[model samples]
Target: MTSGPASSPITDELLVGALELERTDRGVLPHRLPAWARAQCFGGQAEGAQLAMAEAQPAGVRLALRTAATTVELDVVRTRKLYRGVPPRPDGVYDLLIDGKLAAQATATGGDAIHIDMSTGESHVERGPAATLTFTDLPAGEKDVELWLPHNEQAELVDLRADAPVAPVPRTGRRVWLHHGSSISQGSNAASASATWPAVAAASADVDLLNLGYSGAMMLDPFVARIFRDTPADALSLEIGINIVNGDTMRTRTFTPAVHGFLDTIREGHPTTPLSVVSPLYCPIHEDTPGPGTFDVEALREGRIRFTATGDPAEAKAGRLTLTVIRDALRRIVEQRSTHDPNLFYVDGLDLYGPADHDELPLPDALHPDDESHRRIGQRFAQRAFTA
Candidate 1:
């Protein structure tokens, strides 16, 4: 009989798509934003909590290694969010890929839980035991393997075990595509981490991905522009407008200049990079109406959560931003800037998920896309942005 699997400590060198790792009492917590960016959250109580949760979810993170082991095991402590009246969100999925193809998928058992009061904005956490996820009966010889962590869960890696020793996979020198957007790009409603639209697009385009998609937090902050200016990327894109309209964050006066400033900062570093400015996807509720989106309390009473825009359509004429207004402004801005910025590109977000597709694959909550929509968007984005 073969000997028991050998244990290995998880390390930074084996991780991909995470900017930093924090050591916790139980294990290492992967962070998409570096320490400097996380540090800025302090004192901004309103946006801080949302940003904290979004960045810690590790939407595109995974562990890459080469091993001959036919069996593998990973120990993790996962923290999931739960709303008081709503159903608990499902546990995040871990996807195992061998030789660049999806091989298997699994979810961790018992772990910590966080319950949040949506109405009061209060939260409490309860500690629980760690979980071990195992994968067995792999193909015999050594092969490159990747264990993609949950895109929507906060996971702390405790330990790793394999039937044979594991080593880091050598970098493949692939072109790096750095993308920034809101929850849609962060894998909201996607089936798994590897299935996030950006992840799927990167795979199809044969490029490495750096996803800076923060749920509810892509408001064109100066710090985020600085992050873009600093990071090295072969290609860059920004999925703007949705979060801006969702939050009703900026008006035309402020948004127009902010977009210019944001692009200028990125160009400071990536002067000639192929940069694409992506507008918001087709969101029916906010397509024509201005928003400060609100929850459907009636639906909440029925144990279903839904969102509805509270702002009036007339507000758009008064300079309040809606998806339509934002899209128009974005298109004009891209056209005006393209005269001097030859490398800049504009991608109409509606083309990714427009009204026609919405009728067939309507967003369950009236905001985020479902699994199938994510697949189509990713595939379409690959064709539009990468192929062209």
Candidate 2:
């Protein structure tokens, strides 16, 4: 790498110098390699690029990131065999470090999740990798920084930077966003952790994200709200509806009280933070439907599959919950809470994944969205909810 003044942001120029396989007493120069890099005979994976700034300096270096994008750049050799099995899903854990301290971390997974048709012999690059974790407001002082990769897989390092770190833009004071949701928020099938919607929202809005999206277990629990209460946040979002509906976790009477209790617990600590209660997006299966259970016996007998009984059309309309119910519940909650705290907010889940999007971007499994859907959701959020 180009060793210059020690106090510069590690930039693309510096990365170019360190591209070769250099021998060092501490093993090899490129320690980790992604599968694609290995096939190309490039033995080292570019974990990531980082910038170190002085924490105690007079002019404290503020890193203002307009975007945290992750793209896969590779030169695949025809002779190499692409690894099989479900490609890793993105999970935001790839961290950016400054002075041995974590400045920011992004998580991503390789393979098909990023819409890469690896089955065909085509070079793929998934843009806008997700941000899993981020540490901001570094104290101005010189610090050595590095990228901490989540997995040891190999890939070449390309555009990395630190010198001339982008300065933070002036705005209202930072907002801590604490969110709780389901698999979609948990990163699902995204390429890496940073590509997830929550991560995307956090980076775009310039805020902290404490994601509590349980993959298969999003039961509206008092414990979960307790967790939210303990964490410090300036704003909070509860993406409810879908998980409860999909899991068929509770009855209408139970659902109402559970939601109320959950919010009550969160308010114990964050009584004044701007809170937004969101319902489920537009889902035909559960839009006006209710659930107790349903199953596809034909598919099951063929050893193909099974289904849940909760989504029957008539039953859903009768005793089960619908997006409308959630909307009403949220409206009531906000109305009641607004009487005491006027900062409460409500967003319809349909706003995120409405009926219009369904026509163009159908959920691959009739449940979770495809990669395209994820991108659309993130973009919509950036446009509407995140602008504030």
Candidate 3:
């Protein structure tokens, strides 16, 4: 199916990304979750706003090719959602990597955007259809190039073309870092595709990245554990806590066993893989207060969207989950497990984003970090967790 344009001399290569593609009339959608997990969504067993968001954003996915093409273009359908009170998100950016180094970047504009009224919980399409992204000029050689799709929006790969014939780049055989987490790790509000913290950290650590950061879907799902068990990985990290707090998913009692079960499943395949259990980043909204975060009503009325903690602070005593509560529990769990597991480790997420850093780079929407913060986080994580 990928056979270039009628007038072009070079061939087209659309099957460059990791996931299998599902074609629609307009374009092709990428799938990170495997068939079983997707079946959960399709069969109405896990239909919710969370899965809707997770499956859309190509958080850690990218397209790779080894070619001498001077110019490359991708026909893209960018799906952007605008919360009623929030500013319209910037156009999705495509980051290019050449020879395993950041080479160039571009944005996909004038694509289909969806305006969603968060207050009303309703959505409608904004006319602007799909657009083509073209990166031109010359770097004439058989260099390996990877195009990272935007991490924040839904992008349909309409088409891909280059000035020369292209083929899938051979794997570098570098250690694959498999990471799972919530929206922060999912690159929520991240500046661009390759700039997400995990992407940055992975590049800095010189590891092949397999990002499983499913927006709001990082709630210790057994199916995701299955993915971890089956997928090949050299190292693993679980950014735990934030989603549990904000989603108010479970209390300490339930959370403890869930963590054990999740880890046990992954260890089934990666018995000795270096597994790092990460605690939550510092967030004032849920530092001591339990969550079930809600939007700030007054801010929403003023054409702005911000999150506020709703759960009571005292609820922590009753085993309600909070950032502090979850962190402590996670540490204890890792400590206990490490007694029998030599490769297991723990990295405090606060070490990457603590109170001091929070004062310097606060979460913009009272939830997700902005671009500068993402850079700080990626840098700190690389320095702290991946040190020799």
Query: What C-alpha lDDT do the candidate models reach, one value each?
Result: 0.90, 0.51, 0.81
Q: List the residue pairs that clash in candidate 3.
A: 4-12
Write one digit per residue (lDDT tens) for candidate 2, span 252-305: 778878878888898899888877777777766666666533344564455432
Assess the local accuracy of residue 139 in candidate 1 as a C-alpha lDDT between 0 and 100: 85
User: What range of 10 consecutive residues in model 2 has the weakest lDDT sum?
Assistant: 50-59
- In terms of TM-score, which candidate is strongest? 1
Q: How accurate is candidate 1 locally (lDDT)?
A: 0.90
Q: lDDT winner among the candidates?
A: 1
User: Which 10-residue span in candidate 1 carries the lowest summed lDDT?
Assistant: 38-47
Q: Which parts of model 1 are misplaced by more than 4 Å?
A: 1-3
**TM-score for candidate 1:** 0.97
Candidate 1 backbone clash number:
0
State TM-scores per candidate: 0.97, 0.56, 0.91
lDDT of 2 at 95: 46
Ranking by TM-score: 1, 3, 2
**Number of the candidate with higher TM-score, 2 or 3:** 3
